[model samples]
Target: MLHEIVISGFGGQGALFAGQLLAYGALEEGWHVTWIPSYGPEMRGGTANCTVIISDEEIGSPLTRHPTAAIVMNLPSYERFEPLIAPGGVLVVNASLIAQKSQRADIRIIYAPANDIAAELGAAQMANVVLVGAMLAATGALQFETLDQVLDKHISARHRDKLELNKRALRRGGALAV
Candidate 1:
């Protein structure tokens, strides 16, 4: 199956990293994948977004107009993309950062306290990983083990030390789905 996923949030929230991880995991799973990151000029405080496409067949275009799933790390991200989610799509929001809720009835929406969960894990930066965990649970796009492998392979050596903690955050996020 082919799936389009969009992840958005403010810069420094690791939106791009999460999208990259998903795309990398899809590749490891033997799927065709593409990752595209888009952002405004504000750097760390600016809006950052990425589109990831995973398919069993060759991907025609990397650009996604309407995605089948979305991970919104902040209110702005949610407001900007929630309306464009495809019918039957699943939207995962970071409840700790996003104050609003999606009103669409045609899709499934999940709100997780990602920031709080990351804080509890002693690594507030892992908030994005929590969202990724929730996305994995909601969409089943990638396996947790595959995600871990991608993280280990792609994360910078400086941050590689935190791999286990990030994986814990993913597991915690996945627990929310249960």
Candidate 2:
């Protein structure tokens, strides 16, 4: 199977980090993965997006023109990439940040209040993780255990204290997906 996902939001929202975690989880599953992030000109407080591809076979391109899924963390991202999702693809949108929805009928859209959920979990910064959880629930691209392992492996020592909160967000998101 091949899964291509794009995660996009304003800078500092951990959009790129979420993509990295997804790629890492796919890698642990023994899949070939690639992650490519694009930053806006201003860097801070600007739009940022990352493309992650996970495939069981050789991956020819890191860039995805039409992704199988998307995690839109902001309105701008939804506006920009909504048209790019393939038919029958899945989209997980952060309803706390994005106010609009995609008009397409061919895709499955999941509205997750990720930021609000993370904030309630006392780790507002882990909104990305919440979205990731929702995506896993919606698409089953990787197992929840895979995500947990990725978090354990990728979270820095400095952020160790916030692990519980992130886990909580992930659980909440997964619940919503169900």
**TM-score of each candidate structure, all chains considered together:** 0.96, 0.96
Please identify model 1 stretches exceeding 4 Å from their true place: 39-42
- Compared to the true structure, candidate 1 yields what TM-score? 0.96
Residues 10-104 of candidate 2 have per-residue lDDT tens digits of: 98899999999998999899999999998558375899999999999999999998999999988989988899999989999999977886678
lDDT of 2 at 5: 95
All-Cα superposition RMSD per candidate: 1.1, 1.1
> Global lDDT for candidate 2?
0.89
Cα-based lDDT at residue 83, candidate 2:
91
